[model samples]
Target: MKKILLSIGGLVLLVIAVLLVAPLFISLEDYKPEIAAKAKEATGRDLEIGGKISLSLFPTVAIEVNDVALANYEQGQNKDMVTLEQMALELQVMPLLSSEVVIDRFVLVKPIINLEIDKTGKPNWELEGTQAPANETATTENSESSDGGSGAGLSGLSLGDVRIENGELHFIDLASGAKEDIEALNLEISLEALNEPLSLDGRLDWKAETINLKADVANLESLMNGGSTALEASVNSSPVNFSFNGTAQQASAFALAGALDLDVPSVKGLTDWVGAPIERQSEETFGPLSVKGQLDLNGSVVAFDDVSLAFDALTAQGALKIDSSGSVPNIVAALSTGVLDITPYLPPETSGGQDASSESTSDGGGAVQNAGADQGWSDEAIDFSGLKSVNADLALKSEGVKIRKITIGVSELGILLQGGKLTADLKQLALYDGQARGKVVLDSSKATPTTAINFDLSGVQAEPLLSDSADFEKLLGTLSSKANLTTQGASQKAMVSNLNGTGDFIFQDGAVKGVNIPGLIRNVSLDALQNSFDEAQSTDFAELSGTYTIQQGVVNNQDLSMIAPLFRLSGKGTVPMPPKTLDYRLEPKLVGDLEGQGGDSGAKGLAVPLLITGSWSDPKVAPDLAGALTDQLKDPSALIEGVTSGEGGVKLPLGDGDDAGGVEEVIEKPKEALQKLFGN
Candidate 1:
């Protein structure tokens, strides 16, 4: 029995010795052709091993291969899809006997991978042959078996160091003409055991920038077993830096709750580095941005609480949540800021200020001329497609807000958007020293978008408001206005042409900055006269009120009324917004005093008809000679009596051909009074 046992031991020893020493005489390179042939049959791609192959066993099992490559698709741009200068792997043989995989070092050196998508949407990574449909029962059984064995499979797994040195990955989309390249990717990973901590550190050069990345898992086993584990990760790059520290779990689904910090030196720079540069209206936009918050991600829902965000010199604190489980993402946010100045991101206001000298002069036939007519509203299409990409509910409050040259104070706004329709409620707003509240609804679901606004403004300072908003600084007053307007269009020109609205406005204790009505009427002449409103000359009034209706961009106001110390004025007009022209008539009557707001019957005086016509930018102001003559003749007895009594409040020159006094000529021949009075 002892001799037989000895024989068995000797045979086992001989087998072990052979297993340890057999690799010395054998050459793995000799079977390279067979290996390549098998790989081609499996993948339908040529696999080439140009250099030497070495293998070892016994104390450590190791394999090394050099100069390996895989052929690209027949229609691929590159000759070789993947190439590796060298690959080496080492494993502990003793651990394999215990159902464990303990890797000493697994390294890949200078591997290049080219991933391409053809113009026909075919990818090079897709093998030539079709794959058989997976069996449901078999797949379910396999998945259950794998899940049941996962713990045991990974229980004894260990890794000393796994590394990739200077690898490169290229991606190209032929249909989109887009290319992306990651060069010099060096990574190192270390795992003592499945139950212990795991760490990874890596660096990559992309788009002429280097990115440093690191991650740590406190307990890899716990994480794999659907339990929570402490996790920390960071990515640092020239354009942006991001870091997160928190707990991660994968119980029913992956989830995380942690603190995240992200800083971007310049969004534009980061976008450019990613080969997706964004276009901005101003150079000042897309500048520095930073965010810090507590993030909770559960399934497809992500929430950020106590978020502090800074962008383009504007800072705010907010809470935001996003749910992507639906067809479109839904966002909810509440933000507040001290002063939100978004002027840098706003498009510049058009240059619309006209010079005072551009007004009508003697050479222009008394017609006011604008320095230059605006090019008109932009016809560029307004893209509302983005609005349909997501649904959002947002509430924003700010101590002050600035957009372009317009400044507003203490505003609270709530916006809700769903299915390409947006409703904005201005709950509270202080604008131009006034209170403004309004609601705006925009529907972009249709082919042609539509907008409706119901706004009310009171006690607003009109001068500064108009100056900043529209470059119209001629009127100074406390203004109150209400408007309910609706329009449908995708472009400014179309919107204005389709506008329909009803509004009423009142201006109190104001002055018309450019014109003195009395002076203009007193200096009446058939020849051209200056009617510029940009000068310091003005007419003070107690009130100016009007109710207007707009249809197809044409505004008509028939009850315009003004009260002044020396005169009462009434006007009616049509303002075509599309053409930016005005056709208005004003009748001003001399009043006895500033009493009863021009309603006192005793304050009536001579009435002169004045006409304002032409573009809003340059209106022509002149007396309606025919209308005035007819008005005076309608009440000839009162006019003559007043003229004889020297209380007509008017003076006309007698004919130059005759030495007739003006009053006598007017009293003697009422029928031909105007003809005689004008020396006709």
Candidate 2:
């Protein structure tokens, strides 16, 4: 028939020309010590091979190696755990001559791995010094294959393209001196039969950026039969962009369920690329993030449902869970946000000296400055060491919550930490129409950290929370507060000077905007310094309660009280608060029968103590006249009933600008000592 088909193609061209000259008479580097003793009997480390060992067989069986290395753990600095410059392989020589093994490409070109751990956490890719365990024919004759739970050993294998070039991956942790690297790694994989579908695309270079990754699995026999497969991953990087889309459950407990999606654009460069940096004391700048989620994981517990986060102009919604098999990784979350303008993470509002009588207690919400702990409170140095990193139980909520001009309308906050304590509750807080609840905890498991704080608030709105904390807009309206307090100090001026607390407050129809009390009882009004918080001489008050007590930072207010239908007030205090100064005493009375008066302040006509020293930002009120000369030495007609019931008339001035003796010569010597005791 054509010379019998040219004699069977001349015996297939003499067996492909004797398998291409049989590797040029085979000296394959003289079997390189049996190929480096079967790679040191399958990697018990040491496998040198310095260069050249080549072979090939008819468009199939190929192998080429040159300068490989691979050892590790003779201790530290580079015992070389893999280093290959040039490697190439191809198989399927008729299904590995029937032992069935496939693999048609495996190129490596410029690899350099490293992967260490040392300093006690021993790891240099393990497989230490004794190497002898690898039965099943050394798992398909080692071609670097071993994910073998039956089928990553790929049932009758068949992989095709895999080329990694310029690879590098050097990680180190010698006990947290943490180091990482993965440079210029390039990978491309595509498999054809571990039962279909699998592809990977990669690129590396970390920290100095450039990420790019992609993956797809799609079944692969349901991911080698451990169940649900279908995965698609993606990553891009500059400041983060990540993605994932789903289903990879139960591969021996590596379960998953995804839909991640992320974009960062710098959340401090993704926490400085995950090394966690955001140690703020205030040069804040978070940013451009967006999340979106539904992660799930189900094995070591890793949920994250519905999420949807954003930052910079805040917006949140969430659910989270973390659980990593315990030993310190447990988290829970629940979020909500919108309008959480924490002034771009704080520290920018600072304006402290103002007092033109505080401009008549300005309102429209901007005269109450100070807030953020009155321009201070962060003496830094509060590291709580990142709160030991994990254990949490967050819960944040917001809906209006600025933090500079201080405004809060709806808020809910909760946080918990275990093992080094850390509470923080406040569940539900609405201010300015008030309602609050509180808790604060913070115990760093001792050695001086302690801090507890109980709190309560109700019906709030006391002039913008005391004008954003003590800038004092001169009190006005429905308030209620409570505190329990405790401290151990770690700044904030040592927690307000090591405070030991006990607080209470109440306002109700309040007014006190700079005091006038009937013009200091008919004009003993010493020069009227714009009448204090003069909304037309404040002091309306239908109630203004108190109950303070803190020691060690001094503050004691013996049940101060004030009610004013005509007048009735009381006080006694000592506020040492790190020199916030103010030595208190304020007693005014005249609630009944004094003509323009209602009744029963004990039917008193007038009584006055009023001392109030200075420095809670300029205090100093007058009218004590040595307690009305000790009450006219015990009532010698008490200065003719304090000059006909105007106990504070005559301007008994004395805030060091003397004149405590001319109210009609002290009302004529208490009426000439009551007429020499009755001999009138």
Candidate 3:
């Protein structure tokens, strides 16, 4: 029996010897033409083998080739689809008997691959006459292999030294004129066996950035055979760093569930590196960004739970899902944050000087600081094109929020965007000590965009709200307001000109900051009227209420009423928003004595009509002396009665200063009293 086993072993040794010496007798170069012809017949492209090819068999079966190239499609942009400087492969012979592939060495040096898509969407990689038959065979094989019954498949595989040095891959799309080149790619891969861990480390230069990548798969065979395996991967570059620890599987489609961490030192830098730049409103926007999450991705859908995101000065935690199976990607998220400061993402405030007063105003919530026709509003077209890119439903809650100069507290908002229309619903909002509920809709689906806003606010501090929104700090109060407004346009001026709305506001225990109605009436001089906007000349009011309607950019208010200690004030006006001009008239009736006593007596002292005109930035104030004199001319005796007893009609104080004897002299000749009082 020992002799028989020795004889079998000796036969095996003889066979191995013959295999080792086989290459000595046969020249692989002689068959290079046949190999090239076969490849050309299969792919319908020229194959050139320019250098030597050698083969060996002993400890391992090996083949090495140099200078090989394959031609691209005739109409392709590149002449050669692939070019290789050198390639070597080694396989362990003993592993074949056990249905295993053990690669001792597999190295590719200086390999260049060029992939392209023509303008007609034809890819150079799609070899001629290879699609239908290859797909059919793959489908049949996949179906047979689904039951794990394919004997032709390897049972185990191992890679010893697999390396790629200085490899390059280039992709060009003719239709989009986009080109991507990945050069200076060096890679090393290792695997013990099919079920053993596989590791890969590589570096590549892409888009002027050097990227280092590392990956590990716990079981490479399981992953390839429609099973799950543990995976860890990291990619590091100057612009960004990303790492993932996950379980990956490929059954019907590739799927991954993982913990992912990504950090971008500058999102703007990343975008610029990737050849896509974002337009930022401020220098601080789109700067640093980071994300950490538990992520699950299945084909076209990706979900993130326990996700924390930080961008610029904003930080939030959320559960987010994005599904790209539809025409437009759809995102659903629920996020909450401590304080969300969005000012960095807003456009900078307009700067310059105004004509008279440097104050601004707002209608609804749109700041009209630059809403005038000539120089106020910007003529640049507002672009809403990005709204059509995706759809989203987002629920956000924040302890506090800051947008531009306005600060809000304890806010809950729901945002829904679909078909180029975005709606934001303020569920719970606190702003400047006020509670507000509102909904804003922006529809960009049409040629001309449209916006609609409805808001109700109560118990709001008016001073800060106005100051923040419009840079106007003239009014102070606790305010309650309601507004329903709509506009359609593509620019600030056009939108404001098209604005139409109805609103009402009521203020309690407030003072007009820059005007003293009682003092203006008492002095009865042009100088007093001109200086009415002085900061020290404020008139305190117990209550102020007004209702207004807007039409074609003109706000018309006819019921402005204020109850003050020295006078009852009423106003009617038209403010044209497009021009930022005011044509308002305010009437102050002195109902109380100079000592503040006649408020309850119902005695009418005097009525002064004041006209406010010019730009909202620099309004002019003057008394309507002509109108007052007309009333006196009609009722001369009534003027005398009012001047003497402070009762019957509109009265005029004669002297520039407040003196009772001046009224007595004016009472004798009321017409002469009016002329002297007016300086006529």
Highest TM-score scorer:
1
Q: Can you tell me which runs of candidate 1 are displaced by over 4 Å? A: 1-15, 129-152, 279-283, 355-365, 371-381, 521-523, 526-534, 596-603, 636-680
RMSD of every prediction: 5.5, 18.6, 5.6
lDDT of 2 by residue, 248-295 (tens): 865668777878989888787689777887854344458688888889
- The 10 consecutive residues of candidate 1 with the worst lDDT sum are 655-664
Displacement of the residue 542 alpha carbon in candidate 3, Å: 1.9
Clashing pairs in 2: 151-154, 513-533, 514-533
Lowest lDDT block of 10, candidate 3: 657-666
Task: Evaluate all candidate structures by whole-model CA lDDT and list the values in order.
Answer: 0.81, 0.70, 0.81
* lDDT (tens digit, per residue) of candidate 3 on 115-213: 999999899988864345878889988878775732226556789999999999999999899999999999999998878899999999999899999
Clashes of 3: 3
For model 3, what is the error of residue 77's alpha carbon versus the real structure, in angstroms, after optimal superposition? Answer: 4.8
Candidate 2, residue 175: Cα displacement in angstroms equals 15
Show model 3 residue runs off by greater than 4 Å: 1-10, 75-78, 118-121, 129-152, 279-284, 355-381, 446-449, 489-494, 578-580, 593-605, 614-620, 631-680
Tell me how far the alpha carbon of residue 397 in candidate 3 is from the true structure, in angstroms, after superposition. 1.8
